[model samples]
Target: MGDNVVVSNMELEKLLSMKGGKGEGSYANNSQAQAIHAKSMHHLLKEALDEVQLQDPNIPFVVVDLGCSCGSNTINVVDVIVNHIIKRYEASGLEPPEFSAFFSDLPGNDFNTLFQLLPPSANYGVSMEECLAASNHRAYFAAGVPGSFYRRLFPARFIDVFHSTFSLHWLSQVPECVMDMKSSAYNKGRVCIHGASEITANAYRKQFREDLAGFLRSRSVELKRGGSMFLVCLGRTSVDPTDQGGAGLLFGTHFQDAWDDLVQEGLITSEKRDSFNIPVYAPSLQDVKEVVESDGSFAINKLEVFKGGSPLVVNKPGDDKEVGKALANTCRSVSGVLVEAHIGVKLSEELFLRVERRAASHGKELLEKLQFFHIVASLSFAL
Candidate 1:
């Protein structure tokens, strides 16, 4: 059980993708927190869209949702963009031009589910039914682009506006040094940098900077001269990577605890647990600003970090079990695939069940400590 297992790059790609489809454990059903976070930036998205000028009625105004997981949130975000742009054109006494909304994510993403979620109407469900009858302008077209956002996914200067939420924290992969047994940075007995050594944390930080810079570079080329981007990423209030208040560490610590349960039960070896590391890092506001400024591809229009209280929102206050389930499901929706890939389906199921139970046992305390950083930034291509 202690034997080392090497996972191929291809396997890592698939493993890192969010759980696909509309099943019980699917991301589509568990992305409420992300949706809430995105909605909190509705004004930012509107502001970004308002600055977008559709000069040609013939040319389609292109909008892209990078890291658009399979969920209503993606569609909802697109709907907001489309509606805002439509209204902006109308306010200017100009005819609204054609629109195109592209949803991009990794290859393993549930594109089938995303495409199916689209309404028959072309307006992205922004009251398209009424708009279709009221206006002669063409509705927006939808497409799925499957690939990593860390690389180019469109022609140079082709995209008009870009948006991403609950992403940007995911590195292209866990730092190689953390996975290399011979490396001093190897993260032993930890699934993330939450409690890892400074060397391992540094490795993760270096990888994050590289991935983010590459992402900005690719997006700069793909975006038009005046195009705008609104991004909302998981972030942290403290510079210290091990801060328990950091979103990544908060959720990750619980996950690591659940993984430890399996190890204690002898269901999996400690080495296996150590071998798996989540490729997520919550950057501080300064971390994001530095990367964007250094890249020099975009001008930072707005950048601020807000506290997003408990990812789980309980309608009936004091429902500890419900709160726990919500939090656990959100974690599983994102990390279930990785767990299942590492251990197996059965164990992964048991693992999350344990996650839920542990969370429920201390829901009140967990809820208080679950405050997450929501980094919202609005940017436009540099002159």
Candidate 2:
């Protein structure tokens, strides 16, 4: 948009702050998604806690949640874990150990908002120190750390559990090759890794390998032997990495169409559009398995792929305006900051506004058809 407009080092983190102000508009979608998906994993989650060693009655049970965004969406997952652990203690007649949980995200995450929202009721019987004091159960303590999950976040062998959801798909950064003007891998129109050049595809694959490996390596160090990590995140289809079966049908086509319209309106430069791509990669089931197996740190106990669930906050199912606004707000939460960094704030807002209009036209039926393949893995540290 201007010579002054450049991608700052902190821009990505700022973008993830969710609509910039301390408002509810941006984080509404991720919060909703977390609620829906957290329920689906209830059965698998319980099974994961079951595998975790419970013999020690006095030691603190530590759990670290990676990419925990700024709000109750995070608490929802923690509630699930604590609930299961409570059940385990009850069944075994074992003394409940102190539960220390850490919520981690990029330095830019709105952890202030996260902390403000952490009332006991939001914790699902997990966070109220007083409530637990009256009983025999050990208290649950929650803390926030700001950092990237691709690097180490805690001391070696100190953690008992690690959980990440809807977050690992993000690569550390977009591939350098795609943005270089001199490079052959210039992504002309699309924003994602799908349908890119061989060079671009290979670059993404290589980056994903390194990122996933680093993620596993760091976690392996922090997690004790027999510790568990349960991850639920986006994954590509078996037949094709780009085609998410019908998921694209529900949401992708409309999103692209709206962006194309913005280009036609001369809002965003073609050069900028071509060079800009999301830093996310939804790896295939095979891709995830290979990386986990090769890491030699964690033994895969369970790997299940399933679709996304219904919208939580969005009331009406098929209402075009409501659906469109919900979808637009969701994308705006994660990508809006980055878009503004490159295209200038005005155009970025306009772009997603158009996306809302476009999404509304698709109706809820099509949106429901959107593909959301998830990889729910219960991994144990290799002893």
| lDDT of model 2, residue 302 | 92
Estimated TM-score for each candidate: 0.92, 0.88
Count of clashing pairs, candidate 1? 0
Candidate 1, superposed: residue stretches over 4 Å from native: 1-6, 123-131, 134-138, 244-246
Give the whole-model CA lDDT for all candidates, comma-separated: 0.80, 0.72
lDDT accuracy of residue 220 in candidate 2: 84
Give the least accurate 10-residue stretch of model 2, judged by summed lDDT. 243-252
- lDDT by residue (194-299, candidate 2, tens digit) is 6556677777767788899999989988888767898987776654555544333423466566668777887766665765677777777788888999999888
Clashes (candidate 2): 2
lDDT of 1 by residue, 45-159 (tens): 7987877756676677898999998889988888888778878878878787778889999888888888887766553555534546655433677888888899989999899
